[model samples]
Target chain A: MVSTVTTSLADVASSNAALRAFLHGLPGVDRVGADQRAAMLGTRSIKTTAKAQAIDLAISMVDLTTLEGADTPGKVRAMSTKAMHPGEGAPRVAAVCVYPDLVHVAVETLKGSGVKVASVSTAFPSGRSSLEVKVSDTALAVAAGADEIDMVIDRGAFLSGDYLKVYEEIVAVKAACGDAHLKVILETGELATYDNVRRASWLAMIAGGDFIKTSTGKVQPAATLPVTLIMLEAVRDFRATTGTQIGVKPAGGIRTTKDAIKMLVLVNETVGDDWLSPDWFRLGASTLLNDLLMQRQKLTTGRYAGPDYFTLD
Target chain B: MTRLSVRKTYKLYIGGAFPRSESGRSYVVASSKGEFVANAARASRKDARDAVSAARKAFAGWSGATPYNRGQILYRVAEMLEGRRAQFAEEIGGGKKAAAEQVDAAVDRLVWYAGWSDKIASVHGSANPVAGPYFNLSTPEPSGVVAVVAPSDPFLGLISVIAPVIVTGNTCVVVCSSPMAAITFGEVLATSDLPGGVVNLLTGFQKELVPGLAAHMDVNGLDLTGVDDPELALKAEQDAAENLKRVIRPVAEDWTAEPGLERMTRFLETKTVWHPVGI
Candidate 1:
């Protein structure tokens, strides 16, 4: 995998003041327009061949996530194995997402299987810890063989208009990731408005986020279509301007095959087909994988299967 | 001066909310005298799917509730039904005396099943004498979401079929033949303490909706009590077997009579668990 655009992040914003100015200078989002666009894209009928393909593609794009405080090594291993071999002939998930401490367990289980290990660090779900602890959290996961680092932005800082604190924190976490691809979670639900979501997307991108994510799966209204659409638009617009492509991942509450297909439609229409791959897009979901597997089975077999047939990791 | 009477639009009950069929299709229901009653929401395949989704979502909570709690809820349904006796009697379209009897039987049937809610497990479950040093226990559990093709008798049959399915904590999506009476029944459910989605009532042709419910992978059990035609019942059974769904065959019966626990037990799955007796 190519390194994240970390070096140029410094070039884009030489100082904290410069980063703040750049984020604020970005255009505001029209909430109604974003919602309308999301609803319009959601109505796209993907059936038969396109649906079958989309189901498989969506399955492959999943960052099968389990970020509970009670997650054990055994649970991580089971989830990793599930990620690698969801079902017979079904494509493996893009990665297995877990808390920072369980990265090694996932790494050991997923060894040689090609599924990456993504660890959420930097006091994930709420970036309230000091920069020292957050950096060490990222460094620990990286040293433990995590292939990707999903860090949460300080919503407290972002909401308080301290854009510099949130930007520098993302940059610091990205650097701590070393070569591991950095996915910056905006926690868009806590951002309160679509305009804040739009600004956070640009902030994470300009500060060297290889992927801009919508949530930590910890908040209500997480990873909604309209919120995700704004991030997709940000990546599309950012790619057009800077010749650098940043991926988009919508996490949480996307549990059905139907929901995943709608997100795929959003990506297809918003960023075109370029962002459809696992490298460019991901669905940070846990329950969604089983539904996708069920739909895939329905397409292949001519008969429907039950949840009893699928293993829940 | 003239006074105009207000009539209610009989709509499908899904996920606790009354929604017109997604297809926006409706059918007219006329009385035996050939007078127009009301325009009922003619639900399609999509509505069946939606109702199944709702029933499936409600299954976890309803099935997991304490049996005592379930008994209380079922008894509450009986109480609500009793309070709406006049409305249900009027909707049944017969003379007040016969309709009143049907309504009373329906309410009594609910109370009867409500008493079985906590007792069914004890009656059905057993502790087996195992060959090894283990405690082997078998119990019955609600078999997820059930799809009911309610019998033609709108009042008593509807209550009889639905009461048994829900008494043991299995949520249901019912396709009713009498749309007007079903909608009036829905008002009682809404007013009762029962949770939304516990029992979704749909008014449409069973031929149009049954196929979708039968074929839905999420629905675990099917009650074909209303299907009198052999061919339709056979087709529904075949479609239901796509997921190996547990099916209750349609039987000609009197709904007003004393219902045995068979209807309640038919929708249940037996689960046996073994644990070590000693350290």
Candidate 2:
């Protein structure tokens, strides 16, 4: 959590040019090595004593998310309440993620619970809108008392080699976020390569993203082990170079306790123990919470609870 | 070089693919006369858990399949079994006459069950003569994933217990004792049109796998036909109660005898529906 280099909005262009040089000049990743490392870490046998602790840690690091056009005030409220108390003996989730329109409902429901409300903005899932509108989206969510703003990077610009444009948009959104923490979503599925993922990780970090995220949970191949592994290496190297550690969130397709535990293992080995907490690592999933709760109950009490026993919120 | 014999490695079948036991353990198998057969994968509790997961995943598509399609798939399994008759007969390891008879019975049993798939519902379902002005009906539905311990009669007994459970659209994980016969049978299932996970066969000790399968929350039923030890069978029954799994206790019976509706009905859950006459 040390500060090394600061890239301000006034210096975004020159900083982006220099940042591009740094990120591109960064050593190219060998895909086979990254996958092999992830596979080996996945095989690490987390036994009874450690499994119980790992399940709870995974629970606390979850950002219980529901982002859909069908979202409603009641749905947001119920999910937020579930976020506060997942089950008996279960700890509160790190945050409740919702669309900008329902941020107020989540904010009100999570009041006094110490669970932050995260709103997804900037034309989310698809950042095809103008900068003015995207900034306003962040502004509205922040004004509505969102403690965190999850923004989507302009992949179109990034893919077209307009790294500076993507960097400046993030800078503008960061300015709009004001006091709220900013999470930049790379939607690595669309980025198409491990190299692009590494470059996007650096772009977000240099532009002041508090956390570099893997997906928006709306595309196929959203989050994968190899992709997340490459991102963890990016954040780990970023901290070593800049002296500041940024968080990593892998959203989508992670639905079981085993999947969550493997992610924790990846973070533990790749970035070391410092990134294992909710402050540094997160799983953007909803169904995964119930699995963790079920596993936790199994560890505490020697019986498995049926789906009917847990609330479906 | 004198003829190089390609000795086969016997393994467990889960999710339609052959894989070694997750525990990397294997046990030696031999004939009743103590003749060396082969080293078969001795599946562990972890393997049982994996098979249960595979069965659960395959349940929806399997149970949702049309009865006609299921029947066709079961019939296709019989056709494949017929083609591999010599292999099964040799694996069962008796004199030619007895082995051929056992293989024939197994194939015929599959065909019989295949025909029953489309007819069992019609024979079991009833429209009640209720006292009120309402339409009340009861129909049988597949009871989700089932766990089976294949019977002692390696070939015919294995077919008898498995056919009835899956014929009703239920997916199952079977723990067979006879490694040679079970693996050979697994080859037939793989070649058959039956879906990959519809009938997972694990070659290992029933004592090792039965407890894990019985206790698995995802498994909805238990068919302990292969478990001969009364004490072990009782323990599995107790473990199954954790999830209130439908229990099918093992019984002493001749595999070649006429099978009853009891095996079919035991694994079916009768769902009753009521509707007003006006509607």
Model 2 Cα lDDT, one tens digit per residue, B191-241: 988889998989888777887787777788999888989999999899999
- Give per-residue CA lDDT, model 2, range A1-313, as digits (tens): 2133334323435855765665576577788898898898888888798998999899999999999888889999899999999989888999999999899999899999989999999999899999999999999999999999999999999998889899889999999999999999999999988889998998898889999999999998987899999999989977876688999999998999999999999998889999989998989998999889988987777554555567786
Instruction: Provide chain B's TM-score, model 1.
Output: 0.97
Give the Cα error of residue B232 in candidate 1, in Å: 2.0
Each candidate's fnat, in order? 0.28, 0.11
TM-score of 2: 0.93
Best by TM-score: 2
**Candidate 2, DockQ to 2 decimals?**
0.33
Off by over 4 Å in 2: A1-16, A303-313
Please give, for residues A1-313, the per-residue lDDT of candidate 1 as tens digits. Answer: 0133323555546766766666666677888899998999898889999998999899999999998888999999899989989988989999999988888899999999999999999988788899999999999999999999999999998888887888889889998999999999999889888888988998898788999999999899998999999998989888877789999999999999999999999998899989989999999999999989988887886445567778876
Q: Which candidate number has the best DockQ?
A: 1
Candidate 1: misplaced stretches above 4 Å? A1-12, A300-305, B1-5, B33-35, B60-69, B115-142, B239-246, B268-279
Q: Judge candidate 2 at residue A127 and give its lDDT.
A: 94
DockQ for each model: 0.36, 0.33
